[model samples]
Every structure is written in structure tokens, then in C-alpha cells.
Target: MAASLFLARRSLRLPFPRIVRTSKWCGVPALGVHTTAGRMNTNQQDFEKSQNDLKILKKDPGNDIKLKLYALFKQATQGSCNTPKPGMLDFVNKAKWDAWNSLGSLSKDEARKSYVELVNNLVSSEAPLKDSASLSTREQYDTLQVVSEDNITKIFLNRPEKKNAITLQMYEEIGLALDEAAKDDSVITVLTGYGDYFCSGNDLNNFTSIPPEGKEKMARDSAVILQAFVRKFIDFPKPLIAVINGPAVGISVTILGLFDLVYATDRATFHTPFSQLGQSPEGCSSYTFPRIMGLSKAVEVLLFNKLLTAHEACKLGLVTEVFTDGTFQKEVWERLRAFGELPKNSLAFSKQLIRETEKEKLHAVNVQECERLRERWLSEECMNAIIRFFQKKAKL
Candidate 1:
């Protein structure tokens, strides 16, 4: 929860191989800075090397399992650059498969990089793009068949006109999905989104429907959705990944901490901004955010209502990876398949062990903090402040 600076949703335009220089307030040099014009240039040679490696991966049948999986993921997730899905595995000759298997048996780093590259290729691919069609419709919601990288189950999110905000019913639907994923062994992962946003946290418009006394219940309900979602994610012995397409604020970004991996686009922005808006952190972020990032950084994010760029979040270890906007979904699958290739039980065991060690203590802390914050929120001063903030934003 590092307090984040505002991020413009524009595409990155970094100059290559140039150096930039800056002196910190404490006379510290940032780890990756080069001296030029206060900007760091991405090395062109590195980009070329990445490209060449990808080209070899795509062309060489030696790496076909990873390649075919990457291709399948690209097809499933709507990426442009992909090997055709029809007979994708069959397309790989035996020699190529042998080569890929042999390579897989080599260094773990090489295999991991190879996995990332395949995901990156699928994510950054630029042809044969598919469309996410709406598969079901309802009065206030529509389910979509989103582009996903390597999994069979397609994700569905509330695509109502109201900015795809979460509602009680929507939470129920989402909860059911997670439960289903937990039980279904074939479903290795689930990717979620809501229209242009990953999720806008809660639909505050629903607040008016609750009586004043019921506000506490509303807060509790919100917490339940968040808690259940995160708990299922943390305890779900399989790999779970979230591809954050855009502004994953409040609970959206918070819940991401529960997942095994998260991939976000350059356009993605994460924020809490809850304390500033008169609410406290939820989604167990009160605990998870602080652990993943230190308390001071988390305080900066939560207290200031800061917004962070995907790149900044990556640096803070919030986001697992970032991709350009166009390639975001494809890149997500790349990350997902890396998880898919591992032995399922081993992955589950590691995740379970991690959670088992910390669950009781952190969960209690989260509950206690949330309760205290909820009580504080009921104060007249907080109410007035919330009203005023909403009024000011409304006028704008």
C-alpha cells in the first residue's frame, strides 16, 4: 500500500539506451537510474534479445509444449500473435517436442524465462485477435466470454451500465464462480474483469437504499464479499491469477494480493483512497498489503488515497508483471501457464503452507481493524466529511 502518485493512462514512450540523472532528498541513487535527462532509457539490445528469443521459441518445434500452450492461451485470451489453434500440438514435430522437453529439464531459470517469454509472446502478440462476446444477459448484468490465455473456464463480470461496479447480486455471482473454481480441478485459474475496469470496488449508489442503521450491515456485507473472495483465493490449493485490466481500486487491488499471480496492463491503476474517502481498508489488505509492502508504504497508499501506475506497482511487488495495454490479456496467460506447468499438488501445498503459517493471526488482525474502522466511520465527523467529499466531486 505504498502511497501512489497519479498515473496517466497513456502509453509509455521511453527513449532507448539513454541515461537520466537525479539526486534524491537523502542523496541516494535509485537502483536502475542512468545519467542523462532525468529519464532512463530501456536498452534496445535487451528488447532485441527478448524478440529474438521469442522468435526462436515460436519457430523451433523443440519447445512445442510451451509454445503450443502459449498459442492456445493466446487464442483463448484474444491475443493477435498466436500459432493457430487447429492442431496446434499436432503441428509440432516429434523432434521439436523432444527439444522443448530437453530444454525444460535444464536450468529452472531458463524454463521460467521460457515460460515468461511464451506468456509475453501471447500477451504481446499482434494477429488473429478474438473478441470477448457477451454470452448471457440479465436485467442489471451481462456475462461475457473474456479472452483468457490458457484455461478452459471463461470469466464473467457484471457489465451493467453503472461503471461495472459491484453489487450484492454481483458478489454472489462472483463468489459462486470462485467456489466453483475451488472444486473443479480442471479449472487451474480464473481471470476477472468488469467492462473497462477490473472492478470499481463497491457501487456507492447502492448506499442510498440502506437505512442509516443499516449502513453498518452494508459495510459488513461489503467486507464479507471481500473476505470470502480473498480467503477462497488464499486457501485455494491451485494456481489463481487475476489480470487487472484497469483501475483496480479499493477491494479490487486488495484482493489481488490473495492470488498466486496478477498481471496488469500499463493502463491499469491501483488505489485504496479509502481513508481519504472516509472508509478504511478491507479485503484483508489491512494485513496483506502491509505484509507484501511495509507498513509505511501501505500507510502512504491507504492514507493518501494514492493511485499507482502498473510499473510502480510492479516495483513495489504489488503486481506480478505488467504489459502494454494492447497485450495485457495475452501476457496474463503467459503468467498463468507458468503456474499451470507445475505439479498441481506441489503448487497447492506451497500456497497452503504459506497461508497456514499466517492465517489465524492475520485474519484476526484484519477483523479487529475492520471493526474498529467501521465504528470510526460511524462518527458524525466522518459522515460529514464523506458527504462533503461526495458533494465536491459531484459538483465537478
Candidate 2:
């Protein structure tokens, strides 16, 4: 929702994680050299362990559990919900279909992570999910990894193979994650991505997958979603941080304006190619970018589709600091963990003081930008540009 570009979806597939399945996962450490094999190995290890643990459970985990596990297994083994929906009268498969389909466009890796984390929780003699505050704790995210520890709530955009692109479902999930983080006890919140890329941009499938007659509705709805997403940032009470582990694009880059701190790796680059995609800036970038950088520099980025290296963005005040890629995560997260130990209400109050005066202006800019984007989504220019993008992509 915070993106600028309407980029093509990554058509490539990652090799399946061997023995991948569902279990609960949390406390995700900062990623280091997140190669394909390393990710597969970690998830596979958890999968095997959870399966072994599942075999020894004395009691059945119940129908709901069965459906969740089945759905997760399908998601982990296959990808997304590409299967046909079950007929309504067929209660059993219908329930299963509903369960699986609810995952939306969740990538297989994220589904595997969710599956592993859920299974781990269920294996517990006292499952936190059963008759407890499961909404904040046990409910598995389809496209994100969220955990609160060390007084810091960390939200990871968990789609690595697609370079952490923001799918339509991911947009919703991120807003929800931020909502939960805001209400939680954590003194600070951190946002980053899984694997290689911070985020490429909004998946253009959000636009291309429109129903035959739904383009108008889709555009309007997307504008509303984007508006709300930016509102979450504007109104967030706690200190929000962005840990830019790698290259960031689209909303991922633009939305840094709303964050309290943006720590990036030397490898990170910031890009917002809105004009190239026939889109306008969302995330209040129109207003904030000019304020953060000069109007001239902001125009270079928002209009001319400029790409900024981490150091360049830092120099422009868009990023707080840039660390060498070798120690980026270690150094940034160490400081964040320490910062999270600060007095909670004081941090929140201080952040509110910093953001309160501009909250109204930010909200207005979000509305204005989303309105422009809504128009762009249906424009002839945008349609032609998108068609050209897909055509070029198909050849690749």
C-alpha cells in the first residue's frame, strides 16, 4: 500500500523446502547471508522437528486444527490458493477450501513458516491458542513474521523469492501487523524484510487480476486501502523503525518518511519509480519527501524515477544511517534492542510530540495522493504502460 511502482510480479519459483510443513515460529533473528539453501534448511529442520512432535501428541488436535494443518501443508507443498474452490454444499472440503483460500497470495515459504510456528504451539501441553489471547500470539500470518521480544516488536516482510514484494494480501497483513504492534507492550517497533530484498514494490497483479467489470471498483478500493495503510503510519503512537537490510523500492522507500529511524545497509538502494509506472506517490511522499529532502531533490525521486544508493538517501535525510552490509543487521538490531528497553510511555509520548503537529497534514496528503493514484489506475496512460510492462516481462 505504501508503494510507488506497479511492478510485474516475479514469475520465478523457489525450489520447495524439503519436508516443509506447518508449525509456530517466532523470535526470528536478523537474517545473515540468507541464501536459498540456508532458508530451506532452517524451515526443513523445523518441519521435521514439528512432525516428530506431532506424532507423539496424546490427544487429537481437533477439526479446526486438522483444517489449519491441512491448509498449511497444501500451501507449503504447493503455492498460494490456485486450486478450485469446493462447492458450497460440500461442507468438509468447503471448510478446507475456505481455510486454504484465506491465505490469499501467501508465498510457500511464508506458509511453511506459519505452518511450523503453529505446529510448535499446538505441540505445547498448554497451547496458547486454545482459550487464550491467540489473536496477538498464536494466529499465524500468511505473509509476515511478527514477534515481540526484548521490548521490540519486529515485523518481517516474509516473501523472499519475490524480493519481498507487497502483494495485495501482504498490504492488508502489514497494516494489521502495525495495528497489533501499536497496541502491544513493546516500547518500539521495527519493520524489515525477509531474505534479500526489503521490498521491490506493489505487485502489479493487484491491478492485473482485476475482474472484467471490477477495474473501477478495484481502483477505488485500492485507494482506500492505501489511504488506511498510510493512516496507520501517521497515527502510530510508538516509535517505528525501518531496518533496510537490502534494496528497497516503491512504498517501501517512500514510507520511510513516516518512520522514526531508517537504518540501511550499504547494499541498500532506495527507489520510487512512480512516474515510470504511470502512478503517483502514496504514503504521503508527495508532502514528506519535499520536506525531508528539498523540493528539487524530491522531484528527482518522485517524478524522474531516481534510484538512490543508501549513502545518497542518507545524505538526503531519507535514511538515518547506512552500515556496511557485513555488519548491518548485527549493528542496527543491537542498537534497536537497546532502544526498545527505554521507558514505554515516554517513548510513545515523545514520538507523539514529534509527529502530532504534522499528523493532520500527513493525513491530508495521503488522501490527496491516493486520490491521484486512483485516477492513475484507470487512466489510459497507466493501462498502456502496464501492458507494455507485462509484454516485456513475458519475453523474459
Candidate 3:
């Protein structure tokens, strides 16, 4: 299924007119030509062009292509990959880290040249460019509505009847949306729910669907995907803002800690019931919540299973602001659109500066948290807790 999704996404790429901006990089020559342009440093041009090419890619690239892009981008921008490879169990991060590191001593200029050539080849072979809105609207998953307009990408959780309860497929779609946002420099992402509830967290059916004896494989795969999703949020280059239109529960609440800004309606509430569910924290909330709200507050949410009102969450530093329920969406969109209008590169660079110091630590915590959560998911306590939860819900 994963492989098929990969192929589907990659199958269509719109041919884009060559647009390169001029900038200087460490002693690289400025080039002028049809595909290449004037005043831009060769390396910088390649880097920007590669980013543009990535934006047009209909799907996430294969691991090899992704690794090459990661390595080349890092080489061109940061000179080398300094972070250590993630632990083996963290297959995704390790693959990414290793890919960047594999460039070894490759010069920035050479990396830039190779990157530009690769993108040029891909662009030449792909489909003609379509409207940006068309690309964003093309892949509509059952549970997500991804709309990109005026430099803002809004992802609406669409399962109102289910209180927007998330399934594995929803996770995949959200991850893909994030991937697309990452590639497009102009887009700032906003996450919200379609109806009254932001999300009720993981769909219980997702848990019950796994066969009892063969659950390990499913659990492992889920852990990888979930961790990858959270990691994408952690490492998202552009601004990510969450508009909490209503209540959010479990992983939904935990994810708020990772957003650049969070706005909630007056009637909105937040809860992380990891302890109540006999689950350890996911989403690296263990690390991020403490950093954002202090250890005591983090414990209150994770260990004590406290529900936080929007005002209370704002007071605790989890929410950026709260708007009246009637005007919530309007106000949030107004702010997001204003934010989107600001100088794009400045926002990106500032975000990068704020995040750089903690990047490695966040990845480490994510690895640790996922491992512990995997253990908890398989525990007898968690099994009993699940049975009890459904039984209580059934009675209600």
C-alpha cells in the first residue's frame, strides 16, 4: 500500500518554467543561460530550482531520490551534515541522516550542480504545469481536505460524524500534505477540523482491527508512520499554525505543542489522556510540553490526564491566543493571511534559527518516546485498559 501511494504521487509532475533567483554562495560562479539565469550563484540557483522542482513533484520521491535531495540541499546550504545518524530502530531518520552524511566531503558547488542537473532532467520529463490549486486539490483522501491558496495551505480534518477521529490513512494523507508544504516555500500550513470537534484522536476501530496474535508487525509499522508524522511537524521548515475550532483529544492535543502558533476558539478545550488510556505519550509531547509549559504542567497533562480550557491553555503557554467561537475561523484566517504576506524568506530563516539548537534533542526524544510507546502498546495493562475503555463507552 505504501509503495503504491509512493508511485501514485510520483506519477505526475507538472513541467514548470525555469525560474531562478540571483544570489551569491561561497565563491560559486554566477551563470546566465536559458535554463540557467543571471546574477544567481550557481549553487544557490540550483538549490532554489531543486526546491521548485520538489514542489511540483506529485508525490514524495523514492528513498534514493529523497536522500540525494537531502544530502545535496544540506551540502549546498549547511556545507555538511553534522548531526549523528538516528538509532537503527528509527529507520526513517537514520536513512535521512545517513543520506546527508554520505555526501562526505563533497564540495557545495558540486552538490549544487548535481542537484540542478537532476531537477532539470525530471522537469523535462514530467507533465505540463497545472494551476497550483489544482495540484493541492487533486489528492483528496477520505478524511482530509487540503486547500492551498494565497500562500496559505489549510488542512481540514473532514470526518465530522466521527468527530474527525483519525485513521492510519488519515495520518498518511496529513504526512503527505506536510511533505508538500515543506517543498513549497511560499506556503504556510494551517490545521483545523471541519466541524465542532478538532479531533477525537485515533479511531478506536484502528486499534481493534489488528488481530491479537499478529499485532506486532502492525504496531511496528504504525510506530514508524506515527513517529515520522510527528517528526515532520517538528522539522517543518515553514510556519505551521493550528486553529483549534473546538475540542481536541489525545494525540490531537499533544500535537499542538509542535506548531509555530496555536489559536483556539473560546469554547475549545484540549486533553492528553495518555495515562487514562494506559499509553505513554506520543508526538514527543514528553519533550516539547515540558519545554513549552514546564515540567509540572507537562505532568498535569500527561500523567494526571487534565483537560485544559482554551483560556487555561493560553495561560499555560500552549495556545497563542483564543478567539470568540463565532469569529474563530475568520480571525484565524485573517491572522494567517497576514502572516503569509510577510517576507517569506525572513519567516523561514527566523524559524530555522529558533529550531536549530533543539533539532537533535527533539529527534532523540522522539526516538525514545516511540520505543517506550511501542512497549506500552503491547503491555497487558494497555490491553486491559482498551477493553475497559470500549466497555465503558458502550455502556454510555
Candidate 4:
């Protein structure tokens, strides 16, 4: 994101072309472009060409990236966010304001360059996804293996070496996979891991490594990413399932509240050590955890860093069922494949009815959790805690 911000800023010395939104364009946005002939340098020419290409794209680059592009364009063209922040209930406008405001005092030239580079990348990378939609060709993602078959789209977390711990790129990839699955003909979408562990949660490197943009900015960017990532699950249309092949931790465990069904292996454990790292709740766990497991149990895991066994999690309503380790995959897949043959529309509509009333509350909780986490990430306690964590790991 920092690199993209640099490229986007550098490319913006020239004016970007205006974007017209008619529901056909992807994430290019609807910024008004300046077309003064005198300013049409080679860079501006490339920018305009990129704009043209972006308007032709049929696939979205996900909501987070779109907000990013929108913010960059706004900063590049009209200077820093000047409009009054929208009301709390105005989700769309408020989100737009937040994205643009997160840029802080980034100069117009920088914003322009960032917007152009992002647009170019979006245009270039989009075709591959479109072509890969067919069952004959699986969707290509950097950190996820997405394939549709037997009326189900299975998204496998492919970083076994990292215990499937998610990186920033992985978050984006998973969201994109979910977007693809949501619209595809698949009756169900299954999230699982490639290795023995379902997901060990956050890749600590994300916290330890500070980019040139600095820690606070990275935290801002990460919060944006986090909100977008969780939003995918919150708004997912199909029956989303978690096939917990093994241990799950951090956001991986927190997000299960959003899944329609969670099947775990008897050996699988769930843990959320938020306070251990001086971080606050995220993945909307602040609300969902207490609601699902009651206040006492939620406080134990979320505040005191308690870990839960598979059976315990199941009893708490986090996991729907648990199978023995040896037969976990075989039994789970056999049942899932059967479930896939169910009526897609019926399942979708039923889920909608079940989820409709709570969607707004979930979205609100997501915003609150993400914002709080962003502040926590920028706190002295969190930074020092992460440093100590790395030091402890080195000794072991």
C-alpha cells in the first residue's frame, strides 16, 4: 500500500480523466478529470488511457481498493477532504470521507500519481480474474486457491508454511475470492486451510515491520483493510461455511460468528490473545463473542486470552459440530458436497431473512472495532508489546 501510494502520488502531477459511474465500471471511481491540452504530458496521457481502460472493466477491484482510488483521486484533484463528514447513519458517504481523510496532508501531486498507478494495476490485473471464472480454469489469487465444483466454491488458505497466517495481501485476496464466490453460481462457499492448521491468525510480521509511511499510517491502512475484509463475510450472500481443519487463532476465530456453519476437527482449538499483544477486539468479536457465548465466556477469551478446546467452542455455539481428527476431512467434505446440491436461491433467501435484522448492527460493530484496533495499533503499549514478543520469540 505504501509503495502503491508512492507510485500513485508520483503519477498525479498530471490531471486524471473524469470517471462516470453508471454501475458498469469497476473501482475506477467517478472523479472529474482535468483535460487541459497543455498539461497532457506523457504521464497524463498514460493516466487518461488508464482511465479509459478502467471504465471498460466489468469486475470490481473490491470495496476497499475502490475507496482507496476514490480518496486518492479526490486528494489529487480537489485537495484534502473538504466536505463535511457525513452523518453516522450515512454509511457510504461516511466511508468515503474516512478513506480520503486517512490520507492526512498528502499533496495533490502525490495523490494523482497514486490514483493513476492504482488504476493501471487494476486494469492490468482484472482480465486474469475474468478469464479464470470458468470451471475449466480456477481463479488465480496470490494467497488463496479458489475453485468451484460440485456446486460449491472452496477457498483454501494456501500459506501452509506460515500456518496459513494471513498477510495484508492475503486479506485482499480472500476478500476478492469471496466477492467472486458471492456472485458465482456456487450454492455454497467454504473457507478452509491448505495445511494442518486452519489459520494461526495474524502474521506478526505485519505488526513488527514499519513501512516508510510510518506505523500510524500503516495502522490506518490496515484498519481500512480489516473493515473491508470482515465486510466480505458480513455481507456475503451465500451460505458461508468454515471448515476448521485444525487450530484457529486471532481474527480467524473471531470471524466464525459471521459464518453460517462451522465444522471443526476434534483436535482444533480456538484462541484469541488480544490483550497479550495490547490489541483490542476486532472482526466484530466485541459484539459477536458476547452475543454468541455470553459475557463471562466472551470476556475470558477476549480479555484474559483464554483458549478453548474444540468441544468447548462447540458447546459455546462457535462451532456447529466437531469430528475426530482422522475422519475430519473425509466426513466434512462428504456432507458438504451433499449440502451443495441444495437449492441455491432458497438457501440464499433464507440466509437473507435470518441475517437482515442484524446486518446493520454487525456493520456498526465492525466500524467501531476496526477504528478501535487502528488506535490500538498506533499506541505505545501495542508497539512495545510487539517488540517484546519478537524478543521472546528470538530467545526460544
**Number of the predicted model whose TM-score against the real structure is largest:** 2
- Model 4, which residues run further than 4 Å from truth? 1-137
Lowest-lDDT window of 10 residues in candidate 2?
18-27
Question: Which tens-of-lDDT digit does each residue in 1-396 have in candidate 4?
Answer: 111110000011112223334423324445445666656455556655656765675443344456676787678767888989999878777888899999989998777676776665445422323445444336478788787766888887877555677877888889889988999899999998754467777665555556798977887888888898899999999999999977887888889999999999886899887776778877888888899999999999899988999999999999999986544666777898899889999999999999999999999999998888888877888768766765765675
Candidate 3 deviant stretches above 4 angstroms: 1-136, 211-213
The residue-by-residue lDDT of candidate 2 on 233-324, one tens digit each, is 89989999998967888888888999999999787888887776677888889999999999999999998989999999999999999986
Local accuracy of candidate 1 as per-residue lDDT tens digits, 1-396? 211111011111112111112222112222342335432133322322443344432211112223343333223223233222334345334332333343332443333343454435433432213333522212232343333334333454544233345655655666666666566543366666633466656655444566576767765664555556556555665667777766666666777777767788776788777665556666667777788888888888877777888998888888888887545656565556566566766766777776678777667765665565556556666677667766766675
Deviation in Å, model 4, residue 38 alpha carbon? 89
Whole-model lDDT per candidate: 0.52, 0.74, 0.68, 0.74
CA RMSD per model (angstroms): 17.3, 13.1, 21.9, 20.3
RMSD to native, candidate 4: 20.3
- Using all chains and alpha carbons, the TM-scores for the candidates as numbered come to 0.60, 0.68, 0.65, 0.65
Ranking by TM-score: 2, 4, 3, 1
